[model samples]
Target: MNYINKITLLFLLSISVSFAQEKLSKEDAINLALENNYGIKIADSNLKIAKNNKSILNSGYLPTLTGNAGATYNKDNTEAIFANNEVSILKGAKSNRFNASLNLNYTLFDGLGRLYNYKQLKEQYNLTELQARETIEKTLLQLFTVYYKVALLTENVALLTQSLKISKDRLTRVNYQFEYGQNTKLFILNAEVDVNNDSIALLNTNQLLLNAKRDLYVVLGKKENPNFYVDTQVNFLTKLNKQELFGQVKTNNVSLLQIQRGIEISSFQLKANKSGYLPTIGLTTTYGWSKSNNNSASFLLESTNTGLSTGFNFKWDLFNSGRTRTQIQNAKINYDIQQLSKQQKELEITRDFNNAWEEYKTKLFIFQTQEKNVETNKRNFSRTEEQFKLGQITSIEFRQAQVNLLNAQSNLNSAKYDAKNTELKLLQLTGDLLNTEF
Candidate 1:
């Protein structure tokens, strides 16, 4: 009985806890978004299609075998004439015919076109995979940003609530002082206004937090409980070497690698097009059977045949009004354009890396500065509040100190998250974001 009661009590406690506010960590949010995001799902489907298209058979590198069969039946009145001028007529005749064939075809040589085509298919598959990875990286970044935004707003709401409490306490103190004729009517009115403003600010912050959560749900591609709170602490890399990072990004960045693959694919396509100017050799074999039966008033005849044959086939464009040449030239031009695109992508990646590095440094400095400001403001606000209580400072001065502290805290929060944001961008550029936990 005691064990059963313990189990029942634990189950109830678990249920109560589950109904409490949802707590989401940064890693959890990223994992959920990656699993459920519609964009990632679509990219995965496209990757599958590319894999299917990359099959060697689709590239025409494998032999093809096919089978076909047919049957026919006919009934007719027939008349025949012989060379001796004798004529004969049959009242009704019936005939049936059947035919079947199995055929095989394989490419013997095509100027190495099939080999190049197969290589292009492989490159295309690689491009698809790179594109999918890029999508995932982008989605993770967006989720991380929104998750931090929610955390920032949640902190703001907390600060404002604290301010509101301070204002309320001030109002009560002012009212009591006014009753005793120690404080002025103006002081009470001002305290009331401060309390009202803080209330309004807290409400607005709550709404903004809710909206941020909604945006997160969109990224996650699902609806979740709205009363969730996220971890507010922001983390960022403390040290980085720009040169080492740049070298890693040059080879690891998805967009850059994709462009490189594009160039390779275009090169293969150009070679395959050039093959059109040369002759193609192929082999074909066929095995077939046919049977026919006829019935007449006085006689019946039946015939059957079976055969196997094999041959080599050759084809050359010879000349097609320069069409093949035009195609080959176009492919070459595309290859050159892909090369140029690759160069452009490399430049862009370098620029992005430099910019992200600078931004990370700037935000780190700002966050450090804000951290100091928060500590100083906290001390100043504590001193001012004590002074106001002892009648050493005006209510207005105390309120000003409180507001300053709140602003300083808000700035610190923004700085910390912004630093983290830049850090994420740097990781993304270096192709390390996917492996690192936010």
Candidate 2:
């Protein structure tokens, strides 16, 4: 049993040594995640595609030009007879033909369809940008949540270590008292038991700290957990105004902006679909060169033509089995749907913001209360220790005081982190997280 205990102690010591090698600040962790996180990379790629799609060529604002060339060769046997009873026979006759052309087509008018299409493209690009920003916001929220969890656990471990130290000191003092015939064997055994309990608590907290660090590494997109420590202090905004935050949410929230853009895009789609009712006019021009040779022809042996031709083309869907009407109706319905979605999203965001704000305020109050409790417990423990030394308190009473202080400290640490996390949630709802300095 002693051997197993020694092995466990050594393993924990090794982990502690590894974890203390370097320090990682919150900003450094955020930067690492932005550079390596898979979700951010994918969002950036999508934004690039949306940007590329918002172009004149893709929106039908540019003319299309095409060049074509081809050559043909043929061989045949032919026989000819004339009305004057004259016959001619030709063998191995060969013919060759070549043609090339450059064609240009431009839309002269499409009942403003092209204009609406271009506007839709622009709105789509804006929507994608907002989507990417939302992705970043979400990723940062996750990163910070894990980062602070590690910080919280790190602080817990430190508190547990301090508690264990006090236990060990108490046990040593009890042993001395027992040797001097000032304390009973029962007192010594109780002290030893308290020491073991503190040791177990420390061990359990250390294990939790290690696990939290591993989770942080995963959030950082790291393949392996490195030997590093995080900042144990958690800082949060303390002076946020509710009205100002709500105003920012109205203007800066990514989800709201995306929904607004969707509505505009839908409106454009309805306009573009209505354009199907009007005639489409286009301009077409072609410059061509052709050459041909026929060995079996008597009157015309070789011929060539080169010219430029231009024309105007018109197309109107006079009757398309009511397809145009159906499309227009569908587009109008879609536009309505988008408007409803915008309203729904607005209500949802407002609800979420209200909830987060209330939670932040509540957590802040709890943290403040816990802070006072820790101060009070510290004083109580100090007095209890002095009383124990003067023989005014029992070992169990001193141990209880020590445990109370430890619990108070632990609760304070937890409340501090919880309040900080709630503040982050509020910032996220207002779309202020990315701009806030950690």
Candidate 3:
């Protein structure tokens, strides 16, 4: 048993090692998220249902045909008395009966109700398709957001690790100086505290990175694998102007398209309701046959019948307590609501686009500022280190410079990711999120 246990443990370890070695790139992550996302799967299922509903066969465009067959058997005894005092008796009288029929029905006209209903179904089918695209775009946006978050946290871990290294190096210098009677014991103590603090920071940052990777993996429909890691590099966005963005958003946004479809669907509904005020015409045809026999006596009695029928049916609902009118009115109201909703959405689009645009600009500025800050802090930290070594500055001043550099790097990472998020939002608004190469 112990041997088997050992083998199982070894196998699990190997699997973990393999996962650890697999480096997930951004494109791979995006692809996996798209393919495995539960939301996308549901949307695909709904799309299939819509396509099935859109079929002409479901729209009442074709005639209906039917066939039926039946049979029965009976046995009975009977006695009959005549008016002239003559009597007749029969026993064990058996009879068999069978019948079959075929029928067909076709609607010749229904005030064009069928046509309008078919149009509505087609519009609904298109609406469902748009809904699926909306789901895909939203899911992709969420994925990209999480992916960038993981990248930011990864960068944070690296930053803290480097800071820890710097702290340890300073601690070693402080200890050496103290042994040479050139530095105070307090300096050594503070140096050790700095190293400890940096270590703690690195540990916390590493935990955050792990949590983020778990989130990404869950979004990709995978169990949390501690060894799973994504690329850490930050991506910058190209310049975009508000005018071009607004123009694209108005024409291509999925939400707007859905609203337009809503209007179309409402119009079709109104047309269908109005159809009730017009006369309807239909054609029906049927053919039938029946057979019966009695064999209780030597003499045989049998009956067979067959017939064909064809006819047209016409109906007009002159009034229905104004129910049809009410439905039409309701449909009109819904159409108006959809129009208003579309206007509201257009406004929302404008607001969202402007918000994202301004935020992109703000993040861009902050990123640029942090870039310059990092350069300055780098030079300042270098000078501080030289001065500290020459006994021209206190260890506290040197540590302050190191902290400044770390702060600059952290801020830069935040700005970088912030800008990426805005860019993603812009892509979603402009309907470009799905078309972009990950």
The most accurate candidate by lDDT is 2
CA-lDDT, candidates in order: 0.87, 0.87, 0.84
Cα RMSD of predicted structure 3: 5.5
Ranked by TM-score from best down, the candidates are 2, 1, 3
Give, for candidate 1, the lowest lDDT window spanning 10 residues.
3-12
lDDT of 3 at 283: 98
Per-residue lDDT of candidate 3, residues 1-438 (tens digit): 653234335435644664646678988887887789899889999999999998988999899999999999988786757677866677877789999999999999999989999999999999999999999898888887888888898788778868877887888889899999998899998987787677667666766777887888877877656465677676565667788878889999999999999999999999998998999899999999999897544244898999999999998888889998999899899989999999999999989888888888888888889899999999999999899889899999999999999999999898888877888888889887787766
lDDT of 3: 0.84
Candidate 1, residues 1-438: lDDT per residue as tens digits? 553234335434633653687788877787788789999999999999999989966988789999999999988788877677877787767888999999999999998898899999999999999999999999998998898899899888778868877888998999999999998899998987887777767767777987998998899888755657799976666567898889889879988889999999998988988888889999999999999897653244888899999999999989989988998899989989988998988888899999999999999999999999999999999999999999999998999999999999999999999999999899999998888856
lDDT of 1 at 353: 94
lDDT of 2 at 51: 88
**Candidate achieving higher lDDT, 2 or 3:** 2
Which candidate's TM-score is highest?
A: 2
Off by over 4 Å in 2: 1-8, 15-20, 82-85
Clashing pairs for predicted structure model 2, backbone only: none
- Residue-level lDDT tens digits of model 2 in 1-438: 663256348547866696557888988999998988888889999999998899876989899999999999988787877677888788888899999999999999998999999999999999999998998999988888888888888887778778877887887888898999998999988987777777777677767877888888887878886678888876777689999999998988889998999999999999998898999999999999999998764557899999999999999988899998999999999999998998899899999999999999999999999999999999999999999988899999999999899999989988998898889888988989899988
Worst 10 residues of 3 by lDDT: 2-11
lDDT of model 1 at position 115: 88
